[model samples]
Target: DADRNGFVMGEGAAVLVLEDLEHARARGADVYCEISGYATFGNAYHMTGLTKEGLEMARAIDTALDMAELDGSAIDYVNAHGSGTQQNDRHETAAVKRSLGAHAYATPMSSIKSMVGHSLGAIGSIELAACVLAMSHQVVPPTANYTTPDPECDL
Candidate 1:
């Protein structure tokens, strides 16, 4: 309980090859899939604390979905950037619900950090790999070490 804020530190790196569908097809390269859209933004709310409602992260998710020309219902799984921090976990769950509305409850969301620990910024690349693997296998990886869901993180 005391270590709820603690995270396991890990070391790793991942390199992704991104190419346009037409370009990959023209070159006869085996394409994993096309990245339809993406978005990024910084929350000026606080250094260590998030805003009360996690609106900024929700905005990022909404923007990404808008860019992809997809609705929240289209999303089947969410590869969360779960760092094993209680605050972050709750905030992220709130953000997902805010952005996806009702779809958030139906969609499966998981954090890979529980398995490999927190890699800091490098976790993004590793998570991307996990996403690809999930896609290839058509399975959603479970949140390791998770017993009971926190009421604060209903999503």
Candidate 2:
């Protein structure tokens, strides 16, 4: 719940410790994994809504993979911001499949939105936390209220 009554706002913060592979190894730091690459893009079509084609989003994922020198098949998990909204879910699925091709279906993925609702600005970090927790526990969080699955969202 919000601390004040103006609007229901969720808030939190996260910090990650990162270093070069060799540096981490030399220190004997237990590394969870490496952040190979990342890409960001805006949906010019709409400020609050993502484009249905997901062309821009797909390109962003592709660019990240390319920069990481990794193939789509190498991805074991995808931490999607599954907002449970029609457009967002559909577009994200399309973008992922476009970037990962057939490997997208085989890879396990999940969204924390269903469990905690949208936390606005903190959503990304919360979702990342869910991913980290999943990795640590070796279990995927259930997509609560996910009934009558949409075929378009194969993941």
Candidate 3:
């Protein structure tokens, strides 16, 4: 049997099927929410350390919102790239707050990295999968090992 808490590196592959709104409608398929926008950014400041200022991340969020023609307040859920590392967690919190302002406190955010260890190259897709699961269940996954909350990083 696979140990649930044991730490072991593993590898796998997965695929997803996506259809445009018009295509799905024409096929009489039920829609599971639309993916309005997506954006990616690199932490060039440090290999492992994320910038505390979060300018790049904030810009990325803004670009995504603009592309989708939706304001930050319209985002019901934010699937954070929660890497569980100190810098990542703090920076992500700051980024969200900077982008969403007062709404950040009201919005639900989570990181699947707590349930599953960071999967380097596949992190983005894995995170998206967790987001879909959360949206479907209407439940946000808790941030595991969050015993002590950092005051500066409170969401």
Candidate 4:
């Protein structure tokens, strides 16, 4: 687990169709889920690297939770932006813990990038698709290829 280096430049694409809940119901469309909250942030800490403390990511998470009208305890799972780098993993763990408190430990968080590699533009859609599938099947995907857990990235 600690041997993480970097992600491969994978290639893929994904598409998600979002519509109003009322519109979906009126059209008799099967709605997978609704987006209750969303947030994004960046501190310009680095071009491609995140801050060591991951405060930026933590703030985003906390804000989204607040917008969703829920607390950390309401989270059943987490979709991480894990890039298979030491810094990314460690800081992400800290960020989740910071925003979610102890609930972060109990939550199932994983990065689809582990299995699909870093698809760059498409990885976001791919992982979101995975999350939808996870919810549909009521199963959590594992961080594939990982053996021993890293203490730093406890999530």
Model 1: per-residue Cα lDDT over 1-155, one tens digit each: 21456579988989988877888899999776667778887776778877647687888888999999998889999998777677777778888999889999999988888888888888898899889889888999888877776777775
TM-score order, best first, reads 4, 1, 3, 2
Span of ten consecutive residues with least summed lDDT in model 3: 1-10
How close is every model to the real structure, measured as TM-score? 0.92, 0.82, 0.83, 0.95
Q: Which digits, one per residue and each the tens of the lDDT, describe model 3 over residues 1-155?
A: 11123222324444556888899999998776688886877766877666887777988998889889988899898887766556666677888998899999999876666667666777666667667777888888876666666676677
Report clashes for each candidate as comma-separated counts: 0, 0, 0, 0
- Candidate 4, RMSD to the unseen true structure: 1.0
lDDT of 2 by residue, 1-155 (tens): 11111222445666667799999999999887678888998766878788777788899999999999998998888887676667777788999999999999998887666566676877777777667778888887776655676777778
Q: Relative to the true structure, how large is the alpha-carbon lDDT of every model?
A: 0.82, 0.76, 0.73, 0.87
Q: Can you rank all candidates by lDDT, best first?
A: 4, 1, 2, 3
Residue pairs in collision within model 2: none
In terms of lDDT, which candidate is stronger, 1 or 4?
4
After superposition, candidate 4 runs with Cα above 4 Å error: none
lDDT for each residue of candidate 4 in 1-155, tens digit (9 for 90 to 100): 77888887888998999999999999999898888998998887787787768799899999998999999999999998889888888878889999999998899998888888898878888988889999999998878888877888887
Between candidates 1 and 4, name the one with more favorable TM-score: 4
Q: List the residue pairs that clash in candidate 1.
A: none
